[model samples]
Target chain A: MNPLLSARKVSFGYGAGDVLRDVSIDLHPGEVTILLGPNGSGKSTLIRILSGVLPSRAGEVLLCGRPPRGYPRREMARLLSVVGQDPPVDFPMTVESFVALGRFPHQGFFGETTPEDRERVRQALAETDLYGLRDRTLSTISAGERQRATVARAIAQGARVMLLDEPTAFLDIRHRVAFYEIVTRMKEACGIAALVASHDLSLCAEYGERIILLAEGTVASQGTPVEVLTPGNVQAAYGLAVSCDRNPATGAIRVTPLRGMPAKNR
Target chain B: MTPRARSEDGRLRPGPVFVLLGFALAASMALSASTGPVAIPPREFLDALLHGGAGTPARVLLSLRLPRAFLGLLVGGALATSGVAFQALLRNPLADPYILGVSGGAAVGALTVALFLSAGASPLLPLCAFFGAALSALAVFLLARRKSGVSPERLILMGVVVGAFLNAVIMLMVTLSPPGRIPGALYWLMGDLGLGTPRRVAVLLPYVAAGVVLLFLLSRGLDLLLLGEQAAFQTGLSVERVKTATYLTASLLAGSVVAVSGLIGFVGLIVPHGARALVGSGHRRLLPAAFLLGGAFLVLSDVIARTASPSGELPVGAVTALAGAPFFLYLLRRNGGKS
Candidate 1:
């Protein structure tokens, strides 16, 4: 089967320099693709391109076999959703209303929330464990809860593919684990495709079906965690000396960085 | 829960709030029409309004107070709605109708017409003011645009810079003008609604109505924008189109009011925030509530402007600023000076 989302030789730049160079990747249905990169490695840029937030300078991005931009924005939103790095906190709106915003693409021009939309919003809130706090203002929620609220919004969007940029950055460990479990469940049960850009190698190693290690705007390696998280690839991408091992019981890849040599006196 | 939460959960629907405000506005308009220095009695006021009684009371009611009150209502509603649109479009709580320098541009336009065209009738000033406001609004929009798009921060900055420049131009025109024209120009700058004739209000009515309707249609989009631009975009909002449409509609609203009432400063700045504090942040409820509350607030202020002094009426703008500046500071401090 064809990938649900694909980027073909995509390139992007911000006036002065290229941020992503000839990068290509595919997100398959019922699979989790973890994009691993150090700071300034063009992970965010690639996600933005795929989500159609930023048009690629060169090359094409296809969502379900057609150009992402070919679809009307509302139609595009029905098929694809993105959870950004930071959730907006300035507005004083209830979590329920915030989550209901996900139903935008589905609603008519005036965009009134119907009973079905509310039901979806309620289900999304429950899935993210945020039902009890639905009435609370977003400003009053904790960072973890806020992240979940955004996740709930994406869930409520009912998109087939989700693109999350550092979604777990603000989440605590418990919530982070829950979030990954939810993602895993969605992939298995609903055949949802996800492309998550994250820094948490260990978490990605355990949950990610395929890992794409990016460095300097290029895909340095692509394969299973065991293949991509090799010490040599990690060093090449992140410029750090690391040891890679597999957990005996879980059979998950483990990465450990070695200490650097002491500086020599001048 | 908190008192705010209790209130939100309580029996304060947007429908009743609008009705209540509507009643309050009608009552205030009646009171304002009667309570000026001439002081037409309640019985006389009613008789004059209903039966068209012949006398000085009827003449004052028909000629001056009624027109002024109507102007106050339209201008107030226009400013407040404009404020709501600006605040939502820019996603800045501090954004007011005048934040984009449209008022300053209108002031410059009005001052120029007052100084240069001494032969122009009272009706010509608002037309000139509207032109000036539209020109400045377009300039700000152009200057704020970039390859990435118009960010709220850049828009606000451009507005401030353009406003300052317009103010300087207004001052230059004031200094260069004939000495006799200075007071009229100053009163206009200070926001006088005394010039609002029934004809002028009629002329400006359609633009304000159109702007309000356009903004009402876009209220849902504005609500989504509170989630930030990228989130708004990801949710299928054409952020650029929404931004452009909102800015222009808001400018038209503000400019229409400025053209008629000079620059009634505070109604636009405070009414929406006050309305939000009462109703929640949802624009569908907040915009209409702000409109009614704003109309009432300005009519009451105009009442004070006319009644405060025995010798000459205080400028309506002065009354608003007296209340608005303090409220503005309190809002800033309440937001911990961030807005």
Candidate 2:
């Protein structure tokens, strides 16, 4: 099957520095692709490029076989939604109203909310377990709830592909697991594709069907977790010595960095 | 599941609040019309409204008081709407046209036409003011634009710096001008509504209406903007387009008003906050409520400006500052000065 989203030879940079370089990746339908990278490793930049928030300075990005720029903003929004890292909740809007913003792409500038729109928002709220707190202001919600609220917004957009940048950064362990489960269920139930950028190696190993490891704006490796999470690859990508092992109970890859390694070797 | 006393779609019920504000606005207009230098009774006011005449009371009611009151309403509404748009665009609650230096730019435009060109009485004043406001807005955008985007902090800083420099220029012009022109310039600078005429209102109404309608149409986009530019972009909003549209429309609104009624302060800053307090932060509700509440507040302020002294009129700007500055301080204290 054709990839839902694809990037070819994509390169992006700020003045005097590059953030992403000659990076190419594809996200297939109904699959979870985790982008693993350390800080300042171009993960967020790549996600922005894919989401059409930033134009790639070099190369091309296609959404469903068409250039992203070819689509109108509203039309593109309906096809791909992005949950940014730690979106600011400046205005004191209720959780329900905030989620309803997702329906923007589906409606006209002054379009009245139809029954279907309401139903979609309701389903999103329920899916993200935010229905119980629909009336509460976003400022009053916990950090995990806020993250879920943003996810619910993306889900309500009814997009074919979802790009999430460090969505679990503020989420606790329980919510982190819950978030991945929600994404997994979304893929199974709706055939939604997700490209999640994260630094949590274990969580990505647990949830990702495909992992793309990035280091300094380039793809270091791309394969299954067992293939990409090897000691040598991890050490090379992160510039640190690390031991890689499989968890016996869950049979998942686990990476433990050797903290006492010499600076040069690390 | 337990039933809640909310709308089925979770929309805030705004019917009662709108009706109440509408009534308050009508009542304020009536009160403003009835009491002025010459206090006309309600019966006479109604008679003057129904039957046009050339009598003194009829002229005052029809030609002067009625048009001035409506002008107040329009200017107030325009300022308030601009405030809402600017605040949303900048993602800062403290942002308003005057605070962002749009008004200062407009004042310079109007002052230049008035002092040097002697075009104050002509129809060119509003056009000049509009261009001035637009230029100032462009300057702010250019100064605030960074590699990433315009941050709220940088926008405010550039606005204040530019605004201060413009204010200095205005003061210099006032000092250098002929003494006879100083009073008029100072009064205009301080924001007087006495210049209101049916003709000026007719000229300005379309621009103000257009700005307000455009903002109302983009209310949904404005709501998305509250999530910050990045999230707004992800949500299908063209962030740059929306920001540009909002700034230009808001500047148009403020410039039109400033052309007619000099730099009236506080209506823009205070009305949006008041409206938000009444209705929730959703721009759909907030914009209309701000328009209404702002109209009422300005009419009342104009009333105070007319009647505050037995001898002469106070600048409406001064009256608004008297009331608005205290409330602004209180808001700052409440928000812990984060804005």
Candidate 3:
């Protein structure tokens, strides 16, 4: 019933400028939380803080009961995983080997691959539909396939929570939908909580159980999509004229931008 | 279970490749022992081995040729292993063992002992060279580090700067040294295995063993490091700790080898690429593959150095550079725009 991960008034800055200020968020088990914001709106920064990759300038982050940073890196990784924007392609690594890296936290420094580890990797590959391409090197794969590999890696981590930073940025429409479906399946099947940073408003409304809209390094709105995706909120946060309605088929909030309007704060 | 995770590691399958490389290494060692100035025919070589090795051919094989071949194996294996560690640490395939000025520092150390401290071949020369290499490597690491983290770009740049300064020092020492000191200093600089006695091989064995083992243990960590710093950290690798350990261990390997055999170039730079081609990039396999392949490559090069010209032996460094530079250029051309 309680939140699996929570950030309280987390603030972060670089040099003289602040990137995130007074942002608080929570992720519960088996929930799909969509984080929406324009570019440089502190979405990635917040994800980094929540994932313990960056220390918050102020406030705190708690994973389960303790601070995320208090745990050793591997222990923390056992509880949470992250999917970043891009996958590394500098070396020749098969997709299977790349995904198997997620098992590091579970394996000892000198440990051999256990049957369980291999099973997990195989399952992750199968779940992400990467089994066919597992033999191919990362350089030979498409960007969407690479993104899915990142997701597969997180899935293989077997973590309770996942934080994704623009995971669908390079995905085409079908893959974008498939990405959400995979996350949804993971949530339903494993009770894993996921926070996805995205710009796809309609998809977020359709798939995200909760939404946190950020603007100017602050949470402008946090609620169900129908409550937060209003015309006034979108216009204020994005400085664009837009209409908000419901998708007739899915009963999800639909946002449409009006053309030929002189936008403010452009 | 996804077809039981595929039994083989692609077409290369490290087990058989390891066996093949092991045989190649043994054959190269045999050829090296037999092909020196005193050519010991196979029959005589076997007779000496089976007998007490009292004959002249047996003495050359046991006392001179075998020790030098073993030295080549250790030196080549260490350099290639160090190269693998450095490449993983920097997350750059072009990174070599000497990229962080360890070799320059080593050269300075050997030159110092030759020009100022020792009158002749001193036992303390290798020790001094190692300390010099370690000190310069530490200096580069400290210079590159910031509060945020040690960025690979910053580390490489600092290495270049320190290496250049050390080179200047080496030049000044070589230029101003008494004429008698120059030959000893210069020969060491060029790199040779002529000094590979049983004692020298014994002295180097422990260092090479310890360094290679440590690197092998850190193989998984190194594998994660190729994911880049942030991703490696997120994946539960203590990225900074692993990088620091890799830097120190790799420096140790390069430094100790430099002390024993002088500065051997390109074995570190080229062997890992060849090994990677054979076994893919998994460090667990790649490290051993590189070590064996490097051993074979250097011993073969040394064989050519010993017999290529009738006049005298060429420095193995010269041979490696001659072959390695052309291969290096070809690699550069192939990888030009890809990176």
Candidate 4:
């Protein structure tokens, strides 16, 4: 099958610098794509461009078979759910109400939530393991729970594609794994496509079928975990020396770096 | 959340509140009709309302108190709802009814009408207020537009400048106005409710109703917009379109209130803040609650304004300012760390 969404010769930038240049990538159905980069290397920027939050300055984005602009706002929303990395939303809304927001694009602006909408919200909360905390206020929750809550909101949107920015920033290793498994279940159960930006290479090694690395506003390298997360390529992009190895039991790539190794050894 | 708990919102709790508010507002309006200048007893007030009482009491119930209280209700609801929408649109806790310079523009417009018009119930002051408010809104919108979009900062910034200019224009118009006419103009600045007759309320009703319904309809979009512009845009809301709709709707609502009652400050600011504390910020609940509480608040304030001191009456706006400024300080202290 053709890729579900793709960026064609997409180049994006802010004032004085290019964030991503001539980057062409396809996000296929049933495949998880990870965008990896150093802090300022523009993975988030590319994610925004593909999600249609930030327009591409130089190229085109296609969702399904049409241009990004072709889909109506509500229809586009039905196709993709984006969870941004924002400090907790300032409102102290209850967790369920916050999650209910995901149902906005799906339930038309005027209609009440149908039974299907209710089921989707239930399914999302169960997937994120947030069912018990549904009645609690957002401020009372832990950071990991809040992050998961936001992810659950996206799932409640019932979108086929999910764009996540640093989804695990607030999670501990155990919760992070728990979170990814839920995402894996979401993919398997719902066929939702996921494009996540992450600093953790192991996440891609564990969950991603493909990876794209960005450096200095350009796609430096992209391939499967074995090819893209290699020490040479990642080190070049991150400007640091790192070790990459596949876990024999899990088969996920684990990356650890000597913090300040010499350039020659890098 | 065992399914029972998960269904809290879809259950009776949230829905019942609306029903209760509607009953309470209707009762309050009837109560207001009984008190006014003539102090008509309830029986006569109802008789006057239904069959027309004997002379001044009849005129008082029909011509004065009923119209005044109804205007107060409509204006109060409009301002409160506008305040909620504008605050969410700005994503700032401190925003209120006058944030977009509607009050300042109305002041100038009212002053202009005071200075020039003969003022024999000629629709001049309301017309002037509407234009001034509309002009200020357009100016603020234009000034706030940015390359990315119209950011809240730009809107607030433009409002401050244009609001200052409008204030200056108001003072100039007041100075040029005849000294005898100044009291009436000053009454408006202090927010008088004595003047909004049935005619005034009738004139403003359509705008108020349309603006409020627009906000209620856009409540979902407004909820999404609260998640910051980029988040809102990515979620399929046209950020620009929603922002424009919200700003214009808010401006129209505030302007309509200003046109009739001058700048009644506190009900707009305090009512929403109070409702937010109780209902949380989900516009679905908060917006309607704010409107109801705001309506109740102003009617009560008008009662206080009319009855207190007994040396005639204090301006309703002054009463609100006295109350609101303190609440504003509290909000400032609460949000100080955030700013």
Q: Pick the candidate with the highest TM-score.
A: 3
Q: Which ranges of candidate 1 are over 4 A from the true structure?
A: A258-266, B1-12, B110-128, B138-161, B174-183, B333-339
For model 1 chain A, give the 10-residue run with minimal summed lDDT: A257-266
Instruction: Sort by TM-score, best first.
Output: 3, 2, 4, 1
- For model 1, state the Cα shift of residue A53 in Å: 2.0
What digit string (tens of lDDT, one per residue) describes model 1 on residues A1-266? 78999999999998879899889898999999999999999988898889888899999999998888788889999999999855555557878778888999999978877888978987899989998888788888898899999999999999999999888998889989899998998899889999999988888999999999999999999999988999788877887777888877788998877877332221
Chain B TM-score, all predictions listed = 0.86, 0.91, 0.88, 0.86
Please, what is the whole-model Cα lDDT of each candidate in the order they appear? 0.83, 0.85, 0.86, 0.78
Top DockQ prediction, candidate number: 3
Angstrom error of the Cα, residue B276, model 4: value is 2.9
Candidate with the larger TM-score of 1 and 3: 3
Docking category of candidate 4: medium
Clashes of each: 0, 0, 0, 2
Candidate 2 chain B weakest lDDT stretch, 10 residues: B3-12
* Model 2 per-residue lDDT tens digits across residues A193-255: 899988889878888999999999999999999999998888787887888888888899988
Candidate 3: regions farther than 4 A off: B1-11, B113-128, B138-161, B175-183, B333-336
Window of ten residues with lowest summed lDDT in model 3 chain A: A85-94
lDDT measured at residue B333 in model 2 versus the true structure, 0 to 100 = 69
Give the Å shift of residue B333 in candidate 2. Answer: 5.3
The CAPRI-style docking tier of model 2 reads: medium
